[model samples]
Target: MRVPILRQGPYLIASIQAAVTDEDLLHLGQEVVERVGQYRSRGVILDVTVLDVMDSFAARTLRDLARAVRLRGAETVIVGIQPEVAFSMVRLGLSLEGVGTALDLEDGLALLDQHVRRRGKGGR
Candidate 1:
């Protein structure tokens, strides 16, 4: 299924409402990147609360998406990773190394805001 991306202020939020295939994840990455550039968004929040399983490709795609968004002058935060999924990911040694993660949508937005504020203060 195609993920829907919404623009909110300076951020783009993509909420994955169901399980996704590799193609769907790839499409999501492409769409998010394009939307970030199109909207000149300052950050992106990917809500994956509904996903029960995340494979290596999914993890890599998300990690890459975060990196790509960062290069476009935006930050990316992944939220809503269920506890079981997180544990599995850890057990599998899958890591979203440079990506920011939060407990939920609200926390994700706060994290993005924090980054922006820190950058502003540091003149970065």
Candidate 2:
């Protein structure tokens, strides 16, 4: 899997390219957390638009990724979820309430910027 690292102000955007399997999701989560720490970023916006489908493993990995980001003193946001996948997640009872989500990459970036500014002001 090739992960593209994009530096946009205080946020480090990671564009994941390739399917994230269950076995590799953990490592990917760790990588994202490490990258945030390395960059000292306020947040990470994951662009998973390339993924056509999201399975239970992927959803669980996302949850774990959010936790990892928090542990590293950064926030995680998921972007570009397809309608079908979103419906499936909702039907499956997967709650993404605690994690950040946006309809598109641009929206995600904006949200991250807002979050970073808020955190900076609050010293969080």
Candidate 3:
């Protein structure tokens, strides 16, 4: 149940797969946030393309995770949401508020850089 979090300068990337329990997801979120502080990361990119179905609880967990990261002074971007999943989540009123998202991992990384630049932090 160890989630792999990779550091890249001032950023972290977490690619989550399926078959995860709610507890595991919570643990993963905690680890990601902790690593942000440990690494002093300015940005986080969570690749959720591998997730096919996300329950409301899981969605909430993600939202909480993003907020937690932001509270730690880092921007978080959720990337790789499938078209259908995106539609379903929106339809279910699970749209992640106050959270950033991108089409894919590459786009998410670019978005993070943009956020940093917009905040007057030069690109790394």
Candidate 4:
């Protein structure tokens, strides 16, 4: 599907749309991780505002991807989650506990910048 991953300074940004299948997400995970390492990104912000229905598989994939990215020494942030989608995810019992979220892309990028700076200062 070639989800465009833009390199913005030390961060990677992606805007996901349309219906994402399991295979597509898997490839995306791999590609993202590779890019993270290749670019040595400090953080990533993925905009999921256009996703109307986030199924369990997709939610799980996102959570797992975030964790994987962290293991690669990069922070992950999810932005633009609609209220109904958030409620639906909760209702479906898929608690995105460890996943970082923001009200919008700007907030996500700002939050990620802060996280990266804090981590850099903390050296952890």
- In angstroms, the error of model 3 at 123 is 14
On residues 1-124, what C-alpha lDDT tens digit does candidate 2 reach at each position?
5465788877888776666566666677777788787888888888878787777778888888898788888888999988888888889887776799998889998888888789889976
**lDDT value for model 4:** 0.88
List, residue by residue over 4-29, the lDDT tens digit for candidate 3: 78888899998887777888889989
lDDT of each prediction vs. the true structure? 0.94, 0.81, 0.89, 0.88
Off by over 4 Å in 2: none
- Candidate 1 residue lDDT tens string, 34-124: 8898988999999999999987999999999999999999999999999999999999999999999999999999999999999889897
- A best-first ranking of the candidates according to their lDDT comes to 1, 3, 4, 2
Better of 2 and 4 by TM-score: 4
Query: Which model scores highest in lDDT?
Result: 1
For model 4, residues 1-124, the per-residue Cα lDDT tens digits are: 7678899999999888776678888888888889999998989888899998789998888888899999998989999989999999989998777879999989998999889889889977
Q: Local error of candidate 2 at 119, Å?
A: 1.2
Off by over 4 Å in 4: none
What is the number of backbone collisions in each predicted candidate, taken in the order shown?
0, 0, 0, 0
TM-score of each: 0.96, 0.87, 0.93, 0.95
RMSD of each: 0.9, 1.7, 2.3, 1.0
Q: How many collisions between residues are there in candidate 2?
A: 0
CA-RMSD of model 1: 0.9
Clashes of 3: 0
